[model samples]
Target: MVDCPHLRSIAPMKTSYLALFYRSWPRLASKALQATTANLPNSFAIGLFCVAALCAAPVPLKAQDQDPFYYEIRPLFENGEQLGQVYRFRNVGLIQCLNGDLLAFVEARHDVSDHSEKDVLMRRSKDRGTTWGPYEAVWGHLEEDHAGWKDPAPVVDKATGRLFYFMNTNESEKRLFYMTSDDSGYTWSDPIRIPDSLLRPEWKRWRNNPGPAIQLKVGKYKHRMLIPGHIVTHEDRHFSVVWYSDDHGESWQVSETAVQGSDEVSIIELSDGRVLMNIRSHGELDPGLDPAYRNFMYSDNGGESWYGLETKRDLPWESGHGSLAKMELGDGNLLFAIHPLVVKRKDLTCFVSYDEGKTWPYKKLLHEIGGYSSTIVLDNYDIAMSHNHGFRGEHGIDFVRFNLSWLTDGKEHANPTVQPLPQAPESKATDRAIWREDFELADRTILDGGSTAWKILGASNAPIGAAVSNGKFRTSDAGGEIVWQTGRIDIGDAKRISIAVDAIKIGKFNNSDSLRIYYRLGDGDEKLIESLSFSSDPQEDFETYRIRKHDINVSGNQQAQVIIRSRINGDDKTLYWDRVEVARAE
Candidate 1:
């Protein structure tokens, strides 16, 4: 149960050297590739060779390679186990310098209790990230550096403002450290150690791993610095390599080719530079048991010859950790960040690509399916992700500011001051129903005689639901308890609300039949909002009703809440809620 589908690689799909390098071209595009659930074993023991050529299969080009979505993943950082020493900063990046003037990099992690971390901060946006300037510590976690520099990949050599922040430091064991700020990032120089032959000519049994950054797009490959190195956890040998440098910082070469899956490093470069090295193959079904999905190998000789390994390409990655980014749209058109549409119930969607990573077709959700994300590149490119959100002890780091046609051509720009919202505040567009309260949204009540007692296990209900972790939804309850507490109506200056509800409980009593009110909107599985089951009345002693003007849908401009669920006798329910209204029915 702990593995509904989060990261399961049952095992059994042996072929080694990555399925003999995609079975060596079985006659042009035979679909693509994804058959390694896993059984394990065999390397140079060759016999599967599949390349199948890979062109003209889906055949549909132009309009930015037939766009869709998957453009640079983002989920800055979190903690309870991954970011809380008082909660350091975040891991952001946006270095637009061919000469456009914008610098954004934030890694920061100095929360000491002995998870063994040290300061790794940096922040400076100039004018791209909408505003940022309190994060100073351009990657330096050294007392003697005991381990803790975390994720980083800040580049800005658009011809020398000279700044680069490549992280994951520890000095004697968990290697791969970098930092170089000539003055644009404000200040810094100390931590530099990206040496890596892979560290083991025999150094007393090494230990190092933390890699993320394959940013290219300004000169492509023969030396376009495509770096993506990882081998830092989950019991070593998860192998992730893709290193290339053409003397910008000076010397590096490991073109990335040692694949086994379990986060085997992705190196995104498309924008004419073309460098997509995404590798992850555990087993189509069984082996060491950890290969639920993802597999690829394409190197037009850039990463130094990768003869096309394949898998039937089309992935909304139902497993975790899959990110890629590339943006250029001024009408130049080209945006991507695909594969991350997993769902156990929590937010984990990354689909949106105007053709670059090859294909995603359309999507841009950071975390609404659950866990892990990080995508930042702003300064008119407008895309700042950061997800690891709600439902896992209330995970934090969920901020979204989007564009690129709202994730590749779904085209949405109507926030021009959101007006079509007036479900209540008395305009009588139908009956004045606009309402907005800072009650953190949709759930917060506690009473007895006027009976309104809800604790759907906890967090009163500002958006709470988890039939015990199988359905997934919660906005409050538990120590920080306050799941819901907002019933004050009338919202004017226009905010957000589209109403319709039914579902409540508060210390049941009287044995008379006759009650029905149901609601489920917003957590309706990634549509973002839509679910309203209605009806209510048990003679109203308190657990109340009213808010069905045809169920709401008022998308933002200020204030919004529409969540209601009440069932009796079915799951043994007790109810509450009253005449919740909204106006401007459109």
Candidate 2:
């Protein structure tokens, strides 16, 4: 058993230094002038006294003024240590059972990578997460079976008091499995596979998305159960879709591809019975989409069809899994989102949206370092959440229970107005050029997935034989091949970063071919900053190259690298780049 600690005590609340400086300086200066006149010469004594008074001024009370509430973050899985053995945990799922029990599940792996063999494990908390019990093996390794199980998406059908644990086996075929538990989570039915006819014939590899499943609670399709899923196309592309069950768990139906070039979706029902699906767009594969944010779509007719695919920039995320839930707390219903709010998989923050998914004003950092989180509204209306707390690949799945008051920082009754995001600082003429390349140096060798100064990666992301030809970086001869990756160039910190490159298309270029610019900060994942697509007609003249430039605000990162890539469609089409540069703006 792990000891749970209240968040208020463990983490010191941050305060506004500028507010305190402005409020206390006047009083301190008056006191300093009064004490200095009698002690020494007015000018020197006042200067000495003012320095002392400034240091002695009392700190602000904003942190103490905040209304404190009870919250606990309990460690369930730490560094892959459980059941007297070591194994990593990932792909979290949580659900409140009909009988008020909180059931949590995750994929326990021998290692953190996806290809590692793993088991699906569960834990239960009957007393509203005050205490959690030992691990229960729902599906896992057998002597004859070594196939891995991943992505535990659990849903509770409140009307029938049945719990559905949805998951999939990770093998070459990738089969879907489901189990029902009537007695809360005490026991589960034998793992059963969905029939082949229910799944589309083209979906050779279908997997359950990591998060909680939703059961619609309003309108004509009330009580409809929907869980997000995605299928890998024959060309290795992914599309977000939904698996819905109208007749409870007895039968299930698949929905049309809601968003193409997307994966790992989570669905929430908004007011007026519209189902909104938040998606993880395929950034590297999907041209023109900023990978820093997630995409969204809505379905008015339950999960049968979806429309209006749009990107929500308010959700600050970088291609990691996120969970969404609508909280019916107190006077209004608030939409709750939990995901990595930074470019890296750190700062797993909770965002509260008053106007559905339009804007999020209130937020709380649940964990400073987190990954792949799932949230569920508890029986008492508090949020019971779980996430992978370890940095990078190490596994530390911890659970936390918090309420609306704690999440909103005691501003539960405050006006629910949309908070405008701060605009980027304007650039000035004083901005400096940080890094630039003209490919003017002697030719250098480029290798696939190598440490060479330059590399041309093929579809497999491994370096193929290539060289910087004629003072320019050139992509592979094989066009329209899946993905083409170029080597990285380092750029220092900046308040604003701009990436520019001169490019020319050669041979027969298709409309689908695109050039993308990405940036990486430290050890974090590469984020897609901007993308440029080639024109329908290929340019064969030497003077036809055009400058493609993109600017973005990245204030505090100490180091960054610019990653350039190209997605082409057919052979013989290639893109050439020269005069690449990265600069800092005012």
Candidate 3:
């Protein structure tokens, strides 16, 4: 071990309330200030007051009592008991060292941008991340590097007991760099620019993965250090790639392009000595694909080649980084994934898969608002996910500690199977029309004078490839699936509800192809109203078919929503909806 001036060591404590608040000030600021201060003139003062109140209160560390415990590493501003950093923290990179200590790093930035001025800051947790030491700048600290630094992807070399850090800098152009720490992150070497041979000069832009890299322990290329990253082509195409170093970070080689139309990937070595890369689908960048779903690819020969590229429909990923982790359970294995659940980067949820990323049957919400996450399973088996705690990472980065028992509610879903679609009950005789969408005129507004209107599903507050034109509504042409949902409608005096849609299907259909309808009463869950198989229809081009359900249960004077969605198994398919109606039945 070498002594360095940047490192500051703090004594380990079983539980320290002050220590927790000092580091978790950003968490308090986001959670408390949003709830308490609405008309308050100065939110910054209110935030400080809340911090002081929380630290003074005798709050116990509920590491054992509460599952999925949360704590922030750095705060945006200096609070009553904390010293704020020079810049806010984002893009967290975390890993568990060989000595059982946790090394965490974040991008200290004035704003959250790829080219913003940034510095890499780090903190250590000696007590399994119960508490962490203060922040010390690893790069862009002592030197005045005007250009920005980004994406701290750290890896621990088990054979040499050395820690290798990989990051990118835009000093002149986007370039990759590395630094090393021989003593469990106590000291570090100066930043060394990665040679053009490893990064590939032809690639216009290359970025390191925001999460921690992996070192293979039980594979054909055991002890190989692989870092997941993405390079952009001059044509604006994004592809995921891996850089592997077999000699313990001595030399690195760039693997073949992992997958196209994807970016910001996280990788984990599977049980059968293969690497699985979880990709963030950016189909919008490539017009041929569908966006907003988590994609996967396998590297059977240890990052040398990639194949089996497919999208997991169960995981509805919007547009951000996610963490993929493998959990070992009594002779069997389960893969856990952490990402945002909705169309936006909010509601950070954890999805658990029992059959090696084929399907995800178990999931739980870890945080309300989240962005850009990294996860690691500790030696004791508890999972810690470090992520940006804000909606779009405007606040800062925070890590939540949880376990499988907490995520799955202490239950094991062995041999989990996908639940069959719910069948629509037989319809009774019905009469009056409560709501209808004839698609005669286009209404782009989400709501038209308090009455909900039919709108296509979208991301980042903009509609996708769907439109209402020429007396019909057309689904996206990019394939996969497109969902059309109506806003809440008040079903006044109607005891039972029914929905019907008349549409013409285009392109070939498969056995797995389907058109589904769902209804949600009040604030309850969305229940499936009907599922119609396209294969059952007669083979006729441009033939119009009507799908209807007439016996949906509903209460009077309660708000309800009607949803119509379509999925194509393997080919491109579009739905031209001519008419849709939600009627009242007696």
Best by lDDT: 3
Score each candidate by Cα lDDT: 0.42, 0.68, 0.68
lDDT score for candidate 2 against the true structure: 0.68
Instruction: Say which candidate scores most in TM-score.
Output: 2
Clashing pairs in 2: 448-463, 449-463, 480-568, 480-569
Query: Please, what are the lDDT tens digits per residue for candidate 1 over residues 1-586?
Result: 0112422121111212232233233432342322331333444212222322233233422232311321232233344343223454443444544334445444444553224465665444454343445545454322222355555566554433456667654433345556676655565544555664555442222222222354354553433555565443334445545556667676666544344443434556555655666554432322432344455555664565454554424553454444556555544445444334545435455555454545655443443444444564444445565544543313434334445443433343212211121121222234444542212223232321222222332343323322211011222122222223223233444433355443333232344323333333333321222332323433221222223545345344333334343222322333333333345454
Candidate 2 accuracy as TM-score: 0.59
Say what the RMSD of model 2 is. Answer: 24.9
- Give candidate 3's error at residue 204 in angstroms: 1.5
* Top-down TM-score ranking: 2, 3, 1
lDDT of 3 by residue, 120-236 (tens): 888888866777788766766422234467888998887777888988865433467778887778876556556566656567777788889998868579988999988887777
Model 3 TM-score relative to the real fold: 0.57
> Residue 467 lDDT in model 2?
42
lDDT of 2 by residue, 1-586 (tens): 1112332233412322333343456676667667756667778876777776776565532323323453567677666467654787877898877666678898888776787778878888876676788887776633223456788899878767778988876664356778887777776554656655765667767888888999998999998999898888777778888888889788888888865677888899988899988887772345534567877889999989988877777677864888898866446678888888665688887777887877775667777778888997754456778888755547468887765656654556323222221232333345466766666544543533433244454555323323455556666444334333435544554667776666655556556777776677657788876666554532211112334344666656666666777766555555566656667665
Judged by lDDT against the true structure, how good is candidate 3?
A: 0.68
How far in Å is the alpha carbon of 162 misplaced in model 1?
A: 27
